[model samples]
Target: MHYLDNLLLNTDSYKASHWLQYPPRTDATFFYVESRGGVYDRTLFFGLQTILKEYLGRPVTHAHVDEARDLFAAHGEPFNEAGWRRVVDRHEGRLPLRIRAVAEGSVVPTHQALVTIESTDPDAFWVPSYIETLLLRLWYPVTVATVSWHARQTLRQFLERTSDDVEAQLPFKLHDFGARGVSSAESAAIGGLSHLVNFLGTDTVAGLLAARAYYHEPMAGFSIPAAEHSTITAWGRDREVDAYRNMLRQFARPGSIVAVVSDSYDIFKAVSEHWGQTLRDEVIESGATVVIRPDSGDPADVVHQCLQRLDEAFGHVVNGKGFKVLNHVRVIQGDGIDPTSLRAILERITSAGYATDNLAFGMGGALLQRLDRDTQKFALKCSAARVDGCWIDVYKEPVTDKGKTSKRGRMTLARNAATGHYRTVPLADEAVSLDVADAPAGYEDAMVTVWENGTLLRDWTLAQVRERAAAERL
Candidate 1:
């Protein structure tokens, strides 16, 4: 057995003893995962499909049970061997749990339940909470997707105000440069794909492959020929112009775009002297757009200076929006960019009469690695439990931290017809299950059963996810 494939060993150590901690006569438990509100007003739902397909879809084998039992026994934690064996023997090793979530890519307001889980069989009541460690990790990808989505909104706002072509240029404004900045290949695959849900520009190959493997997308993103500081500086300081020329000679073609990092030895001189003066005629006659990448200095000031130099050399035409756009040269600031810095850079350039379309952005650590579960205050808590055939509401309400309070009872995400806003409401009864198609009058249940008894019920395509994410509401 692969070391990481053991579902029993994937959770917190304390979870190994949870089966013995439930209340007496506890026959079932219901739990839900929510963003209790944090940095953003809305959370974009994502990555649950990847988790379900990659992890929960696999069954628990007898070998997995035996390995986990011995490990837990040696680690001084209790292992529920009988419970696991029963699943393997009677239920054919499949987890008897039902999971319902809002459709992937839905922008749900924080504090509403994004996912609900419960064991379908009475004997497997503890299974839901036991897997909370893995399920709640969904917060990572969801937060990354939300961040990317919000960045998209910011870019769209600036583009609409400063550029004539908003729709055509919005998709490629923010590029994902986050693969190496993340913790692992899995993080890159997950967070990278999450960013792709909102943008079409990415340098992370793993993200594109993830979309193909999990979301059934042939090619979810695009990247152009580009150069890094190493490639430029390898030619030595005296040969800097040769390095820039080599890039154009190799990759420049009609109607193509190529980026070359120009900050290795004096960014201003490189952009103003080399790209603007030395190669001025070559850049114009190449018939391809050249993107100058400045990887150092203050993001706003550096980008503004590069744009000014490029406009001086290439000349610019004022569009209908009265913003100056360079002829065949552009600038991409890939350094020191976050939500705050990004806004500042856009403000600086637009205030100088440059259109937002004259620049694009590539974010690395800020896009993928700089976030945590607390960034969005994600939590999965048991909300209801059944004992001796009687259902009781369950929750946590700490007076010291009212923000940490958990919801109670079985809940459903309902959307009002008149307001079109979503709210979490208790089910009519413990046994009631509402479907979106046949919802109660004036309210629609946004939750859909995505997985049941170890089988994937809903598989979303990348295009569908993008469309849902782009919706104004619902």
Candidate 2:
């Protein structure tokens, strides 16, 4: 590692000795994560393997401690011993947190154990005990996946009603444009790949790299060659047609697709006059799909207009389902698209006598940055603590806010056989079986031991996650 890399490792100055008062009992503290499920009924499990492999797997080296132990000791003041010992007892300097949870890609119902964390060695309880931040980090990708999963569900509903081949078109319907809109490159990677769990289209380069690095998938998402307004407008309005022609020449090949920003000047004229009439023959003969993107305007209104105009210019063909599709042309509404607007756009296009296949939606800021821990009401709390060989149920029932009331005791998530809904059960449940399929009549454990100590017990690739995420029972 470079000197700078080592320097960066000891950067968690705030978390150093911050656990001095946590757990209260120095021997052991048990904690588990759950989503209280305010806005979402369930959360799609994702990114745990990524978090473990990327963050906790890379432990703080002794060298990192040697360089910055003094500052941490000073920051801790009277608790300097806490800081010093963490470095002195470093075992490959990695965090000594052991985690157990449902398998990654499992669609866990609300108020269930996402993961439970405790110190591996009793003496090192403090090492993993101060975990508000560490445990909370899982919130991002989980929330992203949940939101994207619901979006996929919504699109699937529309596709089922509107498209003949719902399965074929669902993946490409929602594309990730969230790379530049997120807080960092890492966020782009995690959040982008989370969206890819449900759908395959993405423009976030870091997301693809993240999938390759963390999920061991060489290619996690796919995108078409596309142009932005800067490239289109740079050609000037007078040469707009030339720019469109050049994009087609450079990117459009047989059985290929490319997107071009058509709203640089008048989106209507560009769609109707240029792409519709003037370049109609080229578009028809090019044997490639030219996707027109409207970068600005109300998505519902603008995309509805684009679909009708494009159908007029390029002509329309009815699929088996009787939905009109423009020949060699499509519309991608990227501006102001959220779940609400996405559904609205689909509704408008279908109501305008076109199929949901007539358009795709691209989401940027709303897809990644517009969420928080409260988006799904995520919380990690001590539900059980082991003291002197006895297990005690632990929880907080904050009267000030009933919504903040947390679950108590050592809990295991299990699928209730009668309703097929997952429910959190006390660990002592007589019928609890870890394997859902093998479990007897009443209950099956939904939670699986995914991580133990520093070893990742179960690993999942992007394809595996996509498959598991698609599986209804997982």
**TM-score versus the correct structure, for each prediction:** 0.98, 0.91
Backbone clash pairs for candidate 2 read 59-94, 60-93
Off-target runs (Cα >4 Å) in candidate 2 are: 1-19, 22-25, 76-95, 417-419, 428-441
Candidate 1: tens digits of C-alpha lDDT, residues 1-474:
789999999999999999999899998899999999999989999999999988988889999999999999999999999999998987888899999998898998999999999888888899998999999999999999999999998998899999999999999999999999999999999999999999999999999989998999999999999999899989999999999999999998889999999999899999889999999888888999999999988899999999988888889999889999899999998898898899999999999999998999999999999999999999999999998888899999999999999999988788776776898878645544665555656888888889888889999999999999987532
What is the TM-score (0 to 1) of candidate 2?
A: 0.91
Error of model 1, residue 176, in angstroms: 0.4
Q: Which tens-of-lDDT digit does each residue in 347-433 have in candidate 2?
A: 877877788877788998889999998999888887766666566777888889888887787666776657767777666421222
Using TM-score, give the best candidate's number: 1
> Ten consecutive residues with minimal summed lDDT in candidate 2?
428-437
Q: Largest lDDT belongs to which candidate?
A: 1
Each model's C-alpha lDDT? Answer: 0.92, 0.78
Q: How much RMSD separates candidate 1 from the native structure?
A: 1.5
